[model samples]
Target: MINIKRLTTSDADFGARLDALLAFESAQDASVEQTVAAILADVKTRGDAALIEYTRRFDGLRATSMAELELSQNELQAALAGLPADQRQALEAAAERVRSYHERQTLESWQYVDDGADACGTLLGQKVTPLDRVGLYVPGGKASYPSSVLMNAIPARVAGVAELIMVVPTPAGEHNPLVLAAAALAGVDRVFTIGGAQAVAALAYGTQTVPQVDKIVGPGNAYVAAAKRRVFGVVGIDMVAGPSEILVICDGHTEPDWVAMDLFSQAEHDELAQSILICPDAVYIERVAASLEKLLPTMPRQQVIRAALENRGALIEVRDLDEACRIANRIAPEHLELSLADADAWVAKIRHAGAIFIGRYTSESLGDYCAGPNHVLPTSGSARFSSPLGVYDFQKRTSLIRVSPAGSRILGRIAATLAHGEGLPAHARSAEYRVDG
Candidate 1:
């Protein structure tokens, strides 16, 4: 059963328990670092040979060359055909929504600057260029997440990434058809049958077969997360995602069953997944707890939900809506579902969250699919700083600056003065040259 706590108590010591419930900080031990470093070193030295060896050891499959890992067009088509019509339609629809939403996030090159003289206007702008290649990592251990494939690849495609590669682990030497079909829908360029720390290494430091990518994005298990952290300096990453988390802010007016289901939606992800509820009414907490108990047995993933709820789930009673809002902001949850009657009224109060589901009808699952928002979000407490994955993740911005004679003269004195103040004489001299020329 989910732990239920009353908020009416005046005890200050309750803060400690609340902090413990909110804590999702990664436990970085030396072993994780050592293991990841060994994997990286192996890939760096042996290249394709190391990837093959690691694949055999971890993924329980044998593939000597990168050619064996690459999926053929026929294989992708076959996968799509194998899916039921309804499932296929869902994937296609979700892909369209994901692509449409991300297309809006695309940026274009722009310039803005003017000086008095005809040839003196400075050209100050930013160039938005897509990465030459990108890699998407999809976990395949617990279950296949086709949604993840669409969420990661659609945004990259929309951003005009030239080469979009996807990697997933399959022990049976078979790829999940649903995953391949989703990849097809999202226009993924290549699909590889590889996973774990070694796969990340192959992507970061290209092998004979797998091309090195400018950026790597997607969610994975602990080993995969550790690998991303190790390769951070070598290549860009979306985020070192932690466990899944969802927070629900509900009023007594909302149905307890609806709130419970929303909580279960996240809790079913893994035992480390956190599902939290904050409400002013103690009666709501009791009702939601009862609903969870009633619904747990009916769920196919009941064991997972049970373990997750036992480990990281909580139901907190707050003094009022304002306190509930403050608590939600402090936690900075990945998926925040505002189920209050007047959800829009409290939207301004939420300072941090990866994605906000604004009404009772808008559940977190909608955002995970056709809600037109990127499902790949900053997990754990990263919502406090990082943002959801989008087109920006697949593009790099470069500043463009052109100084004309008159423009340089107008700006040079201040630049020289600032450079000189910082003890950079060469910088000051360079600016002075432009002004005097």
Candidate 2:
């Protein structure tokens, strides 16, 4: 039997135990940071030469020039065309749903005249604009992530981003067709077969072939995360995501096997992933534990699932559903499932969560793929302040201010007073210059 932690809310040490479980040391390794810094500086200095060298050294894909590493539009389309009918249909359907959902999130420029006592007839508002170019880094070796292409690229496209350049490491010159196909379908402008810190650097500081992008988004290994962290101010990046997580609040009515499998879905992502179950029923929790024991041997990725469950997973018995919701707020999990009979009623109680999978039928896996919502959610308790990746992440908002002659006189005095109080004579004088008696 696997050893998943069990917690009871009534215990005196419950809070301390919960805190211990939630605490994950996220500091980057010192060696990884040092290596990333060196790689970033090298790429900034050598450009495409550094890229070629890194590709050969790390990915074992020997190439003479940058042109040899970039994939043509024809190749991308061919990948999409060659997919089996079912895979092709699924990709298209998921892409369409993701596109449709994000289209609603597009921000438009708006302005209004301010006719108040302090400022009369002053035009003030916000001008929304999309990023010029974005770089998407898709992990490409052992596993495939067409879903990530749709999640990251579609939002940028929906926000009217001009160019989307994708970089995926094709180790030993092997490419995942699904990723390329998704790129073609999502309207990516350019595709580069590069990986690791070098790919991030090339995108951040523009090489001979790869154009500089305003932002870089998508998932990668620790090297990529370290590189993104190092070059944050130089270029925008999506969050340095943690392992996958799922918090299921079942009222014990759902089938035990179903609950067990739901936990396994996130656990199979990796050993660091967390899967927690909070219910008011004790016997029901035991049934679920038995189900986990019975089902473990059947999974293809059983070792990973077992490790994740033993390390970070938990089965907590709360006082009631209300207590469960309160605890859920404290944890602020990435993916929360309300598996209660009255799941809709409890949604109001959940103020924090990257995504809430409502009802028993709505699996967390659906949201990861074709659920009409971006699966790139805030992880590691970041949902408290951050949000899921969307078109908003790709759009910039600029404040628009047009001071009329009458409004300038009224607003100038306020500005001058404040500037003088702050000991900024230049600011005061600048505002005074625009003021009239």
Candidate 3:
């Protein structure tokens, strides 16, 4: 039988226990950090030569030149064409759905004239523009995910990014066709068979062949995470995410089996992944536990699921659904599921969560693949302030200010007063110069 924590809201130590479960050491190991810093410096100095050497040493791909390490558009399209009919259809369908959803999120430039007295006719607004180029790092080999390709690349495309350069490490010169196919479907402009800190460095500081990108997005291992963290200001990056997480708030009306599998969906991601269930019904919690035991043997990734559950999974009995919502806000989980009979009613109660999956039929898996929302969500309680990756992530907003002569004269006195109060003589003089005599 699997051993998972059981908590009750009435217990005096419940808050402490919950805090312990939520705490995770997100700090990178010193050795990993040191190694990443060295690799980043080497790549910055040597450019393509460093990339080639790292590729040979780490990926065991003996490429003579940067050209040899890159994949052509023809190859990407060929990958798409070669997929089995079902896989091709699924990829295309998912891409279209994702594209449609993100199209609505595209930010547009807008301006309006100021109407205040003496400040009238001054134009102020925002100009929204997409990044010129973005680099996407897709994990290759066993962790290769075609879904990630769609989730990251499509938003950049929808935001009108000029170029999307993708880097996936093809260890031993092996490429995952699904990833390439997804790239092609999502309109990625370039692909390089590279990985690890070197790939991130190449993207951050362009090599002979790889053009420098404005931002780097996607997932990778500890080395990749460390590289992104090291080069943050040099280039923008999507969040260095924590492990996958799911918090299911069931109300005893959903099937216990359904609840158990929902928990497994996130737990199967990795050993550090967390799966929790909060319900008002104590007996129903036991039913879900039994369901977990019964279903564990049938999963292909049983070891990972078991480890994640035994390590971080929880079944908590709350005083009521209201208490569950309060706890959910505190957790701010990456994925929140309302598995209640009246799931829609409880949506307003949830103020935090990267994504909210409503109703029993809306499994977290759907949102991962075909549900049309970007699966790249804020993890490790970041949902409290952050949000899911979208077209907005790939767009930049610039404040637009155009002051009329009348408005500048009126605003100049206000600026001069504040600037002089801060003890900046130049700023005061500059503003006073624009003021009327």
Consecutive 10-residue window with the lowest summed lDDT within model 2: 112-121
**Per-residue lDDT of 223-307 in model 1, one digit per residue for the tens?**
8888999899899999987888999988877989999999999988888898988888888788998999999989999998988
Worst 10 residues of 1 by lDDT: 1-10
For each candidate, what is the lDDT? 0.86, 0.95, 0.95
Our model 2 lands, by Cα RMSD against the true structure, at: 0.9
Clashing pairs in 3: none
State residue 324's C-alpha deviation in candidate 2, in Å. Answer: 0.5
Cα displacement (Å) at residue 101, model 1: 1.3
Runs in model 1 lying further than 4 Å from the true structure: 1-10, 116-120
| lDDT (tens digit, per residue) of candidate 3 on 120-177 | 5899999999999999999998888999999999999999999999999999998999
In order of lDDT, best first, we have 2, 3, 1
Segments of candidate 2 deviating more than 4 angstroms: none
Could you give me the TM-score of model 2 versus the true structure? Answer: 0.99
Please state every model's RMSD to the true fold in angstroms. 2.0, 0.9, 0.9
TM-score of 3: 0.99
